[model samples]
Target chain A: MTSSIHPTVRLTSQQRLEGIWNKRTYTIVRLIGEGARGSIYLARIGNRYVALKISQDSSVISAEVNVLKEFKKVQGPPLGPLLLDVDDAYISHDLKLAFYVMEYIDGVPVSDWVKREGLSWLFPISFQLLKKLHKIHQLGYIYGDLKPDNILIDRKTKQARLVDVGGVTALGRAIREYTTWFDRGYWRLGDRRADVTYDLFAFAVCLLSLDPHVTIHNTKERDIYKVLNQAKSLKPLTPILKKALSGQYNNALELKSELGVINRKQLQPTKSNRKTATNPKIDFWPEALGLSSIILVHAGLFYFLFYRI
Target chain B: MHTGTIRQILLITDGCSNQGEDPIKVSSMIAQKGIAVNVIGVLDDDQTEEPVGLSEVNDIANSGNGISRIVYADVLSETVQTVTRQAMTQTIQGFVSKELSQIFGQETNEEDLPPETRGEVQKVVEDLGETVNLQVLILVDTSASMQHKMEAVKDAIDDFILSLQARTGDHYYSIYQFPARNQVVKELLPWTNDGKRVNKVFPKLAAGGITPTGAALKQTVKAFQNVPSSEEWRDDSDDIIDSSYGSSY
Candidate 1:
């Protein structure tokens, strides 16, 4: 409608782009990904590698740039791709394309990591992700589109890092972008407004999507309960997942605490017998109290047997 | 009443208007009434030549103070959702800019402001977008050339309504078809929050008529003005639907 603003033209390897404002030059290395908004290229400036996203719409580019900048203001483990530069580049004499450069994360999507390493990596990564999401929520923003495609398992830190800042909307705006499978509205659970509950719901849907036994087909007529029932390895998380899907949690931190409980409950068998001895149904304080009492009784017996004798 | 509601008329057409008044003029008038008019040109894949009516789509949207998109039938659903949300954000941003100018005595876009203040303004815009009530009037061109595209149009509207269901604010949607049986426009579905209600109306749509887009849009201006309040709809929704159905056909 606006005369096709250079998104249709694919940049070849070694194509150079210079920022109209910053005047920095970047050499296109290869295309990393492409979505409805634009194409992301792995580009080189000097020896540094950065991911550059080029789009026809200036507003889309600006929105994402602002989110990335906002992400920097929040103190936490890096929640998303680091914003490096924002500018417009002329591809031809007449055509101007909006682009932004960010730190290129070399990691596989969390779903792929799950497929490769097994389901054990699921809960830990999920916990870590929720921690990141909580920090984001504290800043009054929603990771509007929280799906496996946008989350990457950082190869170096082994932490789950969000990649696409495009959907990082300030809390309360309508969700900017979303995949239907991860959207609660599509499942008839909630609206698409950017809120903590919105992200939590999508996070639960994302977890459901990663399970090997669960298949999320593109259908508007899906029963979320039925889909949750189909999960095998993620079955233990079903309760927490339901809580999120039903918009039960107040914030990501609350959901994180609950997910922590489930994660610990799931890992109890692999832990020491003392931890396994603790009842899974009980609260954390009760578990701590039970362990302390066990320690205290053992200490009293050892002192009486050794020192009193 | 505290939240300023954003009203929109989203028109989906596949061809040029061949009947009645000029759609561009009608859209300009609609924009003057503070209602944004967005247009989507649904192009079939087989059409290799520059699709007809693309310029009208752009002109209508531009003069109507909204955005226009030309998308193929396959991706119509995604485009519809994006265009609607983007237009809502733009409308809110326009208001935010006006407020900024009044406060600072300097005209500034959000992007031009420093990061700290910009972030604060953006937050306000986001909150307003979520809290504001929304009413979308969907106008579809059911000309003979658009018969094959009717399915895609229906799916797009269905998805659009589904997307709206996720918002915090109240949403009401109504559907209009141009060139109905012996009329310029027909009310296919009255303003309702239920997305499933479209199912009953979509199947009955026979896409064969002259494209009287201008007349249809003119009728929509009246529809918007006479929209029954939520209370009124709750009282006699069935009657409204029955009467509209009887009159249109």
Candidate 2:
């Protein structure tokens, strides 16, 4: 369905959209972000806030709507922004625009959350994000563009919600969209297929980016590997990062389990007393027995020599 | 930020640099940061004044340590695949030679090895090629004079991507068309593996406006500068690297 609106048309605040399914009118409060394919807006329906995504390109909007509808059908824990309603509006005599409404996630991006709330939150946040991804993977879909911007973290709820569902691709399909930094293809580690391991690799990079000490940039492959390997904050995650970077993981759940283990190990207190208790004792009987055995062996050797002489 | 792997900027234009920073200087600076800049000059028939851009293209490619090819529009598809693959092969060979020198006591070039050894090395190189991430930022000139060449460019890009996919499954491509209707250079497609995605933007790529080759080059460099951070991580359960290392030992 081509929108009557020109592909370059931009929506302004206070613009109203009536849902085709529910017939609920949503007022666009403000523009959230604009990308090449579409624009996301903060919309208000009565007193409740919802995210209104409007795009001139029908295919882009259709892909997002299809994925959202599929997720809604599965009815599991919310993996991303919930799809509220979708409709097409006539902007002009010759132009029509497609729009969709989703649950508005009021939170900061993962990167900002880390900077504000401290890196300690990354462990729990990462675990939550992984669980979400596992759910999506179980449903046979992959969050193709798994990046800090696409992920929003609720500080109080401690839930990381995936935004921009346009990039989500079905398992085994070529990933439709991706940021070069998070893409294994960009790193030359693997193909751009929507598999569980793809998300796991991006998740590893996400954790690596959380470290203030580690600055991620586009460089030579060797340099990137070196940076990942030498990242001080990622030292504990080095083995995991290397595997993920090399496309070793089966799914996000496996990564989550390992991350949990690492986090728990780091959080546990060191046992100094136990270490001291395991020290060798100064028992004289064993020492004497050892010495006596050595003397007896020497005596046997002497006797053999004397007999030979 | 350092994008791990060799970053390649492939600028395919049919006109000269008319605005902003000199393409050669921009490419030189990019080269200094270990990025390779390659240029493909698409020439049209009946315009034989040796488009001034050809000299700048050669200089830019030379400065960036990449190959420069000037081909007529009709042969662009085949030549594009060849030029890009050649550049990629050169990069892989350079990396392999460096790695070999580091691992062994002697410095050896890929060509110097015997046939059997070379085959093994080639296999390793191909394997490495799959893992070594590559970003190809294609800058296409979409000026009015170049209108007839867009389809050919699209076909060439399609073929190029297919050949690349066969050689190494890991490759991300982004296309930026210059003298864009609204912007100096519009992103026809973001970094993606799916070539069909470009079809959406190709039909709408009207050839008009001035060819701001220099400004587009400057903008292309800026786009490369904005490398986003990766948020994904790997699972720790399987220590593939460790197991491989142990087996080797």
Candidate 3:
């Protein structure tokens, strides 16, 4: 177990750890990533690939483990990593570390996926993430951190799964951690208390981030407002975004309903076809008539000058 | 990523400028480009005397529209963090207060804000701290006079880094030591988040040579110019200045 003070332990491929609680032997394949909390590793249990999160912060790990334990009991569509096992391992004679293994999610980050698949998937991905948040909110939990990096989308399934559950805050509790760009609290539009609306706000930011046209360089209040106002891609969902940003939406369900409307509107061919068809007609007829009148006037003037003279 | 309004340069020194162009003049030029330049003067603890460059530090900070502080070397580790935090808070507050004035009209004061609004303001400030990719270009003086205070300055810097990380968790630092053996300013470390890596350079940074504060400031400004801003997706009609904005740091 690595001491909580110095949590970063370099692990090599094929290293093994015997789960103290489950007595399951897992072989590490490679390090997937590292964060302030600790490191994540891709490990194998027999033929299955699983994700192992090892951290020296016992309290943080305990909070996540607790949340996952509670979250597992809630019956719904799969929302995040499925907890498989939790245990402690001794790395040295005196050092022991807490770790947990969950179902491995094989997918690229949502932002990368959006870049590959295009903006058409933005609504669906956001809708799915919202649905997940709605479910979590119903279970009395809030995903405190909902950023592009925390969400993974399986390209084949078009399924979005959230990672880094450590920041999950109990409903009505102060949020534990969050990325400032996605956080409404950072925008000076809302507080940090965990609720469905907080997640909705972050979801709105997540959408904005995935939309290549919407660029956010600073989380300053005025700057965020400026970016949101100027984002052409977000024009269709401006009202919803405005409401979400201002903390008007009461719940994820309300936000999801609004996004569903946007989804339907985006998919409707008639509305867009009508727009394209009417624009040229409105623009061309006046120009054509004006040109004809001008030409007639010129011809008449020439005829009068020649015949009258 | 440099799509924001806040840009800052932190200069830490122990002595006056004895070579190169005028420091205050250079600071004013940086200010004209909308970059705030702050100065921290480290004083000798053993001697019962004022730091030689205190007045210049104040002048430079004033010209740059920033803050200046002077502290004994022994107390630098404790005060440096506070000074930097104060500078950042003040810089952000300037923007936030202006915004508040716009929203509530020019007559409004921060104290008169509603409790909920005040809380929101606090969160906004914290958010800016976290989201703003702050690039701190630290200009350290390595003149022979700074030798006695070098150890204390190093410790102070380490504390400053930890405090910054703890407070905002979003900052990138670059170190430029003035009056190198051969060059006017030496790049001790490139931009990085690893404090330990930055600490490694301290032992190797021997304090000697004339203090070319002006040349060092100019070089630091040039370093900032070399960093490319994040590529933005903009329509031709968009007229915002593309030079500085976003989290390019």
Which model scores highest in DockQ?
1
Best by TM-score: 1
Please report, in order, the local distance difference test score of every candidate based on alpha carbons. 0.76, 0.67, 0.68
lDDT of 3 by residue, B100-146 (tens): 77676876644345323444565555455444545678888988888
Question: Please, what are the lDDT tens digits per residue for candidate 2 over residues A1-309?
Answer: 111112334767787776543567888888887754578889899999988888754435555777787778665558877888766665555565667788888888888876665555666677778888888888899998888988888655657788888668778665656665776765557766678888888887777776665667634352447668546655677887788777788888788788777774442112422332222222222334567889999999999999999
Per DockQ, what order, best first?
1, 2, 3
Measured against the true two-chain complex, the DockQ scores of the candidates, in the order shown, are 0.19, 0.02, 0.01
Please identify model 1 stretches exceeding 4 Å from their true place.
A1-12, A95-98, A218-220, A253-309, B1-7, B13-36, B41-66, B70-77, B89-135, B142-172, B189-215, B218-249
Task: Estimate, for each residue in B1-249, the C-alpha lDDT of model 2 and write its tens digit.
Answer: 111344678888876777667777877666665567788888878655356546676777877767677768766754565456546555666666666676765887544443334446655554444455566888888888788888878866765665456433456778888887778888888777776676676787788768777677777766654444222112221111112222221
| RMSD of candidate 2 to true structure, Å | 24.5
Query: Which prediction has more favorable lDDT, 1 or 3?
Result: 1
What TM-score does the first chain of candidate 3 have?
0.81
Can you tell me which runs of candidate 2 are displaced by over 4 Å? A1-9, A19-22, A92-94, A218-223, A267-309, B1-249
Give the alpha carbon lDDT tens digit for every residue of B147-223 in model 1.
Answer: 98888888778778877876778888899998899888889998888878988989878887688888889898677
DockQ-superior candidate, 2 or 3:
2
- lDDT of candidate model 1 versus the reference: 0.76
Number of clashes recorded per candidate:
2, 35, 15
Rank the candidate models, highest lDDT first: 1, 3, 2
